[model samples]
Target chain A: MAEKKIKIIVAKPGLDGHDRGAKLLSRIFAEAGMEVVYTGLRQTPEMIVEAALQEDADVVGLSSLSGVHNYFFPKVVELLKAKKLANVLVVGGGIIPLEDIPELKKAGIAEIFGPGTSTEVIVDFIRSNVKAK
Target chain B: MFDVKELEKIKAGKKKWSEGTLAKTLSKAPEKKAKTTWSGIPVETLYTPAENAGLDYESKLGYPGEYPYTRGVQPNMFRGRFWTMRQYAGFGSAKETNARYRYLLGQGQTGLSVAFHLPTQAGYDSDHPLSMGEVGKVGAAIDHIGDMRILFDQIPLDKVTTSMTVNAAATALLGMYLSVAEEQGAKYDQLGGTIQNDVLKEIICRGQYIYPPKPTMRLTVDLIEFCQKYVPRWNSISISGYHIRESGSTAAQEMAFTIADGIAYAEACAARGIPVDSFAPRLSFFFNAFTDVLEEVAKFRAARRVWAKIMKDRFKAKDPRSMMLRYHVQTGGVTLTAQQPLNNIVRVALQTFATALGGHQSLHTNSYDEALCLPTQGAVTVALRTQQIIAEESGACVTVDPLAGSYYIEYLTDKIEAEIEDYIKKIDAMGGTLTAIEQGYIQKEIQNSAYLFQKSIDSGERAYVGVNKYTMEEPPVTDLLRVDMKVGEEKAKELKEWRAKRDNAAWKKSLDKLREVSKTDTNVMPTVIEAVKAGATVGEVCDVWRDVFGQYRPKEFIS
Candidate 1:
């Protein structure tokens, strides 16, 4: 039998509009043999979680550059946990400061990627951390 | 140009030198990897008079302040006065941003450029759910005229020019600004500044758009017409390519798309029956000064020349000011690195030098620590000092267009101009910029460029100093400016209280008038100003627009 492909949903939550990273990463993820779904700009946390649920995503990657990640990132994690999909890995990126990463991880985000992070590093992180279906 | 015999002699001598001295040098140390500019323009080994044999000095590059202003728009560039040192700043509450403004002005900054928060830019009130985490983050949150008043408190409107970087809701923001100016006892004609009121770029590069192209274009044109009549000194639209470049377009693409956008705006105004010369003079441009010094300088010069021709030949603009392309330059933000944060200071200095050499009307330098978070006071001061050093001490600003006569510079300028013209023709063929954007042509081109840029860095074809090479491990960056998380709740409560205490009946009546005006062919700025004065919030006025013109849902073009 063929190996199950990891389904990843990349979303831009809140009002931030810097989507160059998200768009590029979606393509990179697809090239790495993952099924990638990109939810366009200005998505609410509810909408992001709903995308994850509908796509049966094993991992959700969130991108926010307008500094609203603290509220929106945690809310998505909470909604996913509440929906009993806690095993799914969650990763976030964008101009996120180091001081805020601890709280974000404590809120159930698996990892946080800051600026200058390579696509290979992110792809590797998702491959290793994604939960089994 | 040289005479025919002289050109032939030089060309033959160059061939002989290439076979003799150049061949000898190549035999020992072969030329390094083939070089191309950031825009993919090939760099030659050497340039000589043969390269510019057909150059016409009179038409292509005239004297400063003359037609086809390739040298500059002003006769005495930087000798009369330096470019305005405007730092784009705002965050947290209006009071906080107001204090920052005062601090910058006290530090010898010449102008104020306000950066509104994302929610405010998208026409959302502070209390709205979509605005929950975004209030007062990227910029100050202005819910209504009350916040606008605080934002300019004690800063005399006539003393310092203010450039507000607000779009999508530009009409409401400009209305609030004009209302505040009135409160300051400043006449409309005395006000001087710019509004980055370019909405076409929002649909192409930035994602802060609220309405679709048609209605958004209406709002953009309305502001232009209103400013032409009332605010004569204010630049109505700052057609920008800074965001386009930051989104990873080549320098040639940036120049092409920006001028294309300017063409679209001029066409729109003419379609509205406004005289071309009357409004074209107030149209300004904003560009990004990237790290490629010579290429950026060439891009700016070529853009000026192209705009001058487009105005004089295409639009038949008679006024000399109408043909001039006045612009502001901000150093590239995407060049900053989070790894070796201090290196960004040097990058900013180089970009600043390029802007000064390129002849800009104003400039904004990014803080060294911006790649990590909002700049601290110390970081911002350093950025301002970088500009001051380049202006006062660098000795680069003494001559207007100092690099104008260089063979390489002139050749690059002509080549870049031709490339820009080609792109403009293609866009024109595809039914202009509006249709090109709707068909996702512009966006796809930018995305492909952005992707190629990333791939170059990823594959080590491009060497980013601290990122891909000379690697280092450093401790976490601290003392960066952090916007308080409570800024949202506080501003939301303030908005709720202000809404409750305001004259609700008056506000509703003014909004009704605005709605009625928006439906008709009449200009919407007059009623917008009235609505803000009557205590109508930004979100409320935009809600009327959303109700009438509808919101824009962009079709996802990227896979």
Candidate 2:
């Protein structure tokens, strides 16, 4: 029997129009032979979690460049928990400040990639963390 | 054919090499030179007269303001008047942005550039449910003409040239601007400025598009045709390569992709039976000035020369004005570093100098604090002062195309022109820009470049100042602008009250007419103008198009 491919959902939370990093991650993940679904920019917490659940994703990666990540990222984590997606690995990347990293991690974010983070690291991290059910 | 003993001598490092080293280096060195940047432009040890073989005074780099304007667009570029120092500044309510506008004007800013918030950009009112927590976050919030009035309260439109960084809702925004100018007693012919109404780029680089591409293209042509009649002095469309570069495209990609989109628009208008000259002269451009100082200068020069040729040869444009490429440039926001935020001021200054050297008609310097948050008052002022200092203090404005005669600059300029033409041919083969965008060809190329850039930073090949190298444990802090949460409530309340008090009958009539025009092939700008005149808000006009044209579900994916 063949191994099932790990499914992932990449989303952009809030009104951030900067999706260069997010879209690049999706392409790298797909190139690495993972199943990736990207919800384009301006995704709300509800929309992100809903898409993650619908796709049956093992990991949820959110990108926010609008500086509202502290307010928006935690909501997605909380919504995922409420919707029984607590097992899903929640990840994020953007212009997240250094001080906010720990709080975000404590809220169940698997990792955070900042501006200069490589696509390979993001792809490898998702691949390593996300396990097939 | 070459001497093998000499090549072996150079390869073994047995002798000091100079002139004869070229042939020996080619033979003995690695077959492929490792490329640092994309777009296939090689980094040489140093370029000399030999590298500039084909470049001549008369043919390659003509005098500024002449045919094949590789040097510049005007003979007196920056000597007579410096580039318009237009700072991108706006946030909070219209009242607050208006105050900032007055302050910037007082600081000697020649042009006003409006940066609307997410709600306005996406064609939603501040009161819309989707606009929660985002109202006035990125930039100023404007829902209707009432807000527009306050946004430009005391500023005279006829005197100062305004540039609105708008698309998708460009027609609606331009409609509001016209109404305001009319109220201020500024004649349409007397008004001047630019609206970045290039929707094709919205699909390529920026994702702030409201409707699908077909309807969006229709709306874009509508603005071009409408501006030709009413706002004769206004630039109907500024096809932007700025966002494309900000999205991590190379300079050549920016040049090729932008001009390809412009070509598509020109062809679109021609299809509509509008004379190409009527719209081509009003077509301006917006570009990003990156830190590759010499390469950036060369790219701008190459862009002008290439665009002039295309207008003359392909479009058969007779008027010299139609072929002139007038543009505004903004320093690349991606180049700014948040770790050592203050260092960004120096980076922006270098990039701004490159833009001025490139002969941009207008320029905007990004604030240092932008990497962390929306710019505070002091940060934006510093950015503006950067441009002012260069214009007044530096001798850069003393002559036109000061870097024009440099052997290396001319070679780089021609090289960029050739590379961009190659990409343009590839895009054209894929059925022009619209089809290429739909097929994700351009988007894929940008993503590849972005990925490689990140990989380089991660691998220590590329050294970004406070990131990857020059390690900093704690980033120095700076004050960042935080929009007051009250702004959302206040704007929502204002819109609610305005909706209740406005004349409903006339609004509906105008909206219905606008909708009817949108459904057909009729020019919708006139309908939009009438609707705006009758108090039909921007949201209402956008909603009508949203219904008729339907919303754009992005077909391309990152995968």
Off by over 4 Å in 2: A1-6, A30-34, A98-111, A118-133, B1-40, B476-478
Q: What is the TM-score of each candidate against the true structure?
A: 0.98, 0.92
Q: Candidates' DockQ values?
A: 0.76, 0.48
Q: lDDT of all predictions, in order shown?
A: 0.92, 0.84
Report interface Cα RMSD per prediction: 1.0, 2.2
Give per-residue CA lDDT, model 2, range A106-128, as digits (tens): 87888988766657778788877
Question: Alpha carbon lDDT of residue B305, candidate 2?
Answer: 89
Model 2 is docked with a DockQ of 0.48
For candidate 1, the lDDT comes to 0.92
The top-ranked prediction according to TM-score is 1
- Give the alpha carbon lDDT tens digit for every residue of B1-559 in model 1: 6788998999999999999999999999997677888767899888888898878899899899999999999998999999999999999999999999999999999999999999889999989988988989999999999999999999999889999998889999999999999989999999999999999999898898999999999999999999999999999999999999988889989999999999999999999999999999999999999898999999999999999999999999999999999999999999999989999999999999999999999999999998899889999999999999999999888989999989989999999999999999999999999999999998888888988888888888778889998879888898878888899889988988999999989999999998898999999999999999999999999999999999999987784
